[model samples]
Target: MPLHDFRSDTVTLPSPAMMAAIAAARLGDAARGDDPTVADLERCAREITGKDDALFVPSGTMANLAALLAHDCRGGEVIVEEAAHLYNSEGGGLSVVAGAVARPVKGRHGILAPASIEAAIRGSANPAVAPTRLVCLENTHNAAGGTVMPVETMAAIHDVARRAGIPVHLDGARLFNAAAHLEVPIGALCRPVDSLWFALCKGLGGPVGAILAGDAAFMRKARRAVRMLGGGMRQAGLIAAPALVALDDPYPAHRRDHALARRLACGLAAIDARLVDADRVQTNIVNCHVDDADDIARDLGARDVLTLSRGKNRIRFVTHSQVDEASVDAAVDALADILATRPNWSTPCRESLPT
Candidate 1:
């Protein structure tokens, strides 16, 4: 165990097959729709997600921005889980670029209750109220320690949105991990939503890129939105070629990451049950509660186990293709030793963790 980089799944290096595909790729103009490899990757994305069409984008954030713009929801409201990546992360692209406001609602462990959303939705009947135009959901929700939203829950939320005549968009950055955890076809999860995007980089192990998929008409609008955002890549097959290799067989890799995450979680719990709820981990991220989280993160880094401290007591560890069993054990042992050595390590978590 040299040094375990548990910072994020995005830290994963591209696989050999991915690099080879890039070198052997056939290229053309992607903005003009002539890149054969980009077309192939987009076709594959459409087939997997069961969408009428798909558009490749530079990043998941941009894909989400394109979806927001394409939905024609400017000056409207968007409902999302309070802990959703779209609200907390993404640098406020929803407001700055799409001119849509986010109305954050609370959810239990990152799974939204349909009733909560029903209560939050507003119509234009009152001038003071902004009409809710879209509802966003995240599968394998990030801030809740990678907790998963079940298909039944998704369908229920979609039903609520449908009754309100609001469209639903999924920010499925770790969609493959969710599908693997549920042991379902990826298309099954996409069936209920109006549109969604999934990253090829996280857990899928691509070097870069993501795919946004929706109905043919929506994609046409999204394509123009992508151009408006200056996301047009002339020869984007350079990015898509490697993403194709990621799609070759992503489930196995997703499962592997999940297994490692569980291992890390259970190991951390054994050191001290209060450190983490191992059972809460459904995918590749392990979040632990520790006093002085920044202090602990620094100590762990000095010992060669890299992890991120989120706020006062939360530390996030992501298992990716890069780490193995030895890496996990080393991390667990390092934490155990640190806690044992620290004088005031027994202090309970004081602040509430959001998400």
Candidate 2:
């Protein structure tokens, strides 16, 4: 049997069409802005993100770091969700590289409350306190089971930031997944933020790269940050070409991934409803609360059903372009079989699961 890898959408291999685009792509020095394919990709990114300009970067981490550095030049504070990828995953790049302090606030399913954001903003009168220079929001929040922050919620946060004269940056690594779930144009979701970045590798199926989009002024500063961080790539058309293909028509594949996630969630719920909330299985991430998650992940891996352990009792399964409905079903069956063989395994009470 073929292995079903549900560890992450980032594991997806480039499609045949993407390979063809890469082979036919025109190349030049990206640093000198002569790369035609990179230029096309940047223009396409701006159009999709509804931004005045866009810059291609090596990874999602760099894309977000560059945006943070551009928004907060001096030592200041950035308000972000406590469990956001920037705060929990990015290895302190915002604080160390950008010289910005992170002020984390709790959110409901990764959706920041407007009041919480307003309260976190520091008053300019207090010279001793670090001024809040930026507000960061993540779409399809990874740690929160790929929950999508609604456009209205984003607009509310934008309103708060605008009134405070602070710029808002979106860590939109899975922006397309969120858009696919909402069945809206990608621009509609991007309209509220001053700047945003999305990964081409995750879900989009590109081998590497991410795009940061904003106004030309912001991008000008961001380009400086990119260079400062050693992200200047030459002859980048090889990667940019495939990224362009991923961006052109990502919705169909993303929608299929979401459907498969729902299938996986349903299958798991059948085995044990307490394992996951099927209703919350939105986009391509299915987070389950399992007993001894680490052990279960190990057993599943041995069975050729790869998964990721998020915490003591939490496991994350992500569906991507490479995984189909059959793969999802096989994974579910394998998991069910593994759990059955464990005598100590017992479904937890529904109330014990996180809301």
Candidate 3:
């Protein structure tokens, strides 16, 4: 049997159609703005995001870094949720590359409260403190088991930022998942923020690239930032071609991935309800709590099942285009068997479960 890889959506390989599009791509020097395929991809991205302009970059990290650099000057502060990927997963690029400071605020399941956001904003006449430059939000927040932030919640945060004269940037790496879950157009979600980015390589199933979208002037600033960061490319349509196809209509794939994730979460709950809160499995990522995450991951790997250890006692499983319902079922069965055979395995008390 083939390995059941549930580590992340980034592991998904491009489909054959995507490969064909890549091969037939029309390429030119992207640095000079002549790559037709790249232009087409950016146009599609802009249309989908309801932004005035969009720029394709090498990775989600770079897209976010460009947005940060464009929105804030050196020594400026960026507000983010404590569990956001920007604060925890992006390798400090916001500070190291963009020369910005991160001010983290605790959020509930990755959604920042409007009051907390307002409180974190700094507007005093003191020069000692860094002025708040931007507010960053993650939709379908990765660290919080892919929880989707409601439109109302995002609007509230945006309103607070607007009143404080702070720009809002959305790290929407999995924005499609959030849109699918909410049954809303991606543009509806994008409207609240000043700028946002989404990954084509994640649930969209493109082999490479991400898009940063906003107004024309902001994108021009982001383009310069991309070049400054050594993110420019020549004949980049090889990657952009596939990304165009992925962006054309991603809802079907996103819907399937979300369904598979829920199925997997439900199955895991049946085996041991303490393992995961099925109600919290809102998108494509399922985070399960175990007594020993590393031990469980290693054991699952031995069975040709792969999952990522999030911490001391949490494992993450991400469903994508490459994983089907059958594969999800197989993974759930393997995990159920493993837990059943462990002599010391016991359901934890509800009060003791991690939130």
Candidate 4:
């Protein structure tokens, strides 16, 4: 029996073509600037993001952390959305590892308020306050059911940050998703920030890696920070080759996933389960509320369905390139069955942070 894996896109395996690319990759000493494949990937990413340079990192977390470290050089603070990956996920690496503070502002879903951003920046003005040096925004924000923050909002934040002389960094892990969902070019989605990073592993279908693109000078600094974090790779072309393949063959998993999410949302809504706003299903993620996620996840897992129980009862169902239309619909039907038969199911509850 096959397990319907709605756990996350990270579970996606590389395609046969990607494997061939990886196997045929030519290797060189990356530390000494001899890896031609990694070099090409970096160059390609720069061109894709319309940036002066790009640095290939082992993971999105490293790329984001390095970008932040480069942005807030003088032990400065970073303004970000309250539920951003940098704040909620990443294990507090920004504060503990990089010696930078994250000043989280209230935002709807993963969307940050420009007014809230302005207030946060102004609020950090006391003598003891850490200098606000950077603003980070996530598009197709993962925590917000993969919501797409519009380009105008991005422009407004960019304008505010520019006037304050603060650099803005975008944690564009699922940027391609944002671009596809908005029907905009990836470069247009990236025009608002000083630095941006995108992931190759998730949805892009690469086996491993992420890329951080920025101006030439900032990239030079980011390289040093990369070394500081021991991310300086050797023979990284092995990973870069596959990333090149994934990027070249763009797919509509973003839209398909969004549709799957809507199906899941409507299915659960029919059963009256505590759920996220169906209208906000913009990309691939579907965050739903269940009062007993542990038991529910276990129940589904026993039936060969996997999901991420974010909290005690909050679950995140993610559709990927691997989950075909049939699987998506089956998972929705499975959930409906769960809610229908389970004695504790069928009630909406208050939204609370996953415990």
Candidate 5:
């Protein structure tokens, strides 16, 4: 049987419409700001995010790095969640590439509280320590089972950052997912931050690209930083074209993904109540507890169902735009079958049990 790939949204390929958009793209050098399709996409992004400007980068990672480089100019420190993609998933780009230190603070789930920000700031200060110049946040935080950070929490952190005279950058790779889940406008989820990055390649389902949106001056500097990092592409309209479609297509892809997640989560809970917490199944990500996650993955791989271990014993199933209801049901049935017959799958999951 074919694999029901729920490993990550990045595994999704562009739809047929997206492929058509890519083929029909009007191209020009993006470095010289002449790429018509790219320029159109940027304009749409700026309008959508209610920002003065937006720069299209190759990936969400680049967009986050660009925002950080533009905002944290003074050899400073960045405050981030202990489990943030920027802190845990970005390969230490803040320290290695931006030459800044990440001051990570433990937070509830993946959402950072205002007090944590204030405390982290206070702890990082002194003449001997790097100045805390930026606060980074993630919405639909990946490491925390795609948890959505509430708008109030974001406003509180923004208030704290404002009082400290620091800029806030939101790593909103899944910002649209959060907006869809909260039934709010995407702008409402983004307006409080000094800068924000959103992905075209995630649930939006574009082939490759992300947008970094902010004020005019911020984007001007960020464009330079993107170039310095060798992310400046020529005729990038090829990718931007599909990204534009992904942004404009009036599809409830995220809601569909979330619905499938609910289905999968519910089905998993039915089989093993102690395994996956259906209540924690938010957005499109589900973290299921099982003993020996790698062993489970290997066993599932034999039947061609891809999964990722969140830890030693926690396997993550991420629904995406490409995963339909049939696929979700098939994956769930496969897991149930695995549990019914396999020795390892039948073993009790003490370490992997969801809290």
Candidate 6:
């Protein structure tokens, strides 16, 4: 009667070690920059990302928004991949909060090509157009089944941005997942961008927190943005302590999460090829394309298998530190049972956004 939860890594509960760290952490006013534990966490983040400084924030959305604000991107244009979570899911914070417009360029599986970004640039020659201020990217891109952008491609984009005198901000929500998949150091993956933010919650097993990292000057501005966005915290050591523990040894668990995703993908592909492409699953997420996502999700839930139906014909299954091989197998078995009953559920149809 155990539930196999494949909804998202955000659903993961904190571990015993993280809980213990939280209870034993020292406290101070983090908003005023006096919390020792918060400082420790910030130092750790900076070291990990090879940035000159880092600021801890409450969520990935806030960290990204702060990055934009710190870069003074208001009334400017930010080039982002069309399927990026920042453009589609971040509640339009880019436009509403920063007064910056998003120029969405289509890239293959959430990886933006440097040429595509170069073509999307605007306002440099003409004062009438919004000047391109920042370039945003996502690694282990969510909407594209957790595909990891190559480090080489990152460098190429950075080169193009440098020539254009524009800064780049990376939405590295599942950064560790990308690092583990590529077998590269976190710092190397981050060196090409001006600023980037990574969540301590997803896959890292922290209760909550994200870190925005950049140069000291940019961080000073980002700190102001943090306060303006109501993200200043007192005694935030409670959050930082657990994040520290999670960061200590994160990659191995992320590697296992990637393996679990592949396992789920292979199982789904075996059951029905149209349901998934195992090769496209690069990290912890398995984004399946099935016409009967809603009915399938409901039936699987009834059988104690929880899932997320992202759009009308899409289901997203994310593996995390808490999910095991048994959970993956159980989810596959439940889906198999559901598909057995409805043979024509995978019929070919035109894909449309979720309504």
After aligning candidate 5 to the native by TM-score, how far in Å is the CA of 331 from where it should be? 1.4
Model 6 agreement with the true structure over 215-294: per-residue lDDT tens digits: 88988899999999999999999989999999997888898899999999999999998788788888999987777678
TM-score of 6: 0.97
Q: Which model is ahead, 2 or 5, in terms of lDDT? A: 2
lDDT score, candidate 3: 0.90
TM-score of 1: 0.98
TM-score of 5: 0.94
Most accurate candidate by lDDT = 1
Q: Tell me the lDDT of candidate 5.
A: 0.85
lDDT of 5 by residue, 201-289 (tens): 88898889899999888888899999998888999999999999988842488898899999999988998886677898789999887
Per-residue lDDT tens digits for candidate 4, residues 1-355, read 6778989999998889989998999889887789999999988888888999898899999998898778764577888888889888999898888788888887887788777777777435587878888899998788777888999999999888887888889999899888888888789977888999999988787889899999988999999999999998999999999999988846565667667777777766666635556666788888877778877787778777899887775788887878876676677677767766776554445557421
Residue 349 C-alpha lDDT in model 6? 60
Please provide, for model 2 over 183-270, each residue's C-alpha lDDT reduced to its tens digit, 9 standing for 90 to 100.
9988998899999999999999999999999988999899999988999999999999999888887899899999999999999999
Query: RMSD for each model, in Å, please?
Result: 1.1, 1.6, 1.6, 2.1, 2.1, 1.7
Task: After superposing candidate 2 on the true structure, give the runs of residues whose Cα lies further than 4 Å from its correct spot.
Answer: 346-355
RMSD of 4: 2.1
Clashes of each: 0, 0, 0, 1, 0, 0
Give the Cα error of residue 316 in candidate 4, in Å: 0.5
- Distance from true location, Cα of 115 in model 1, Å: 1.0
Better of 3 and 4 by TM-score: 3
Per-prediction TM-score: 0.98, 0.97, 0.97, 0.94, 0.94, 0.97
lDDT comparing candidate 4 with the true structure: 0.82
- How well is each residue in 254-297 modelled by candidate 1, as lDDT tens digits? 89999999999999999888888888899999989988889999
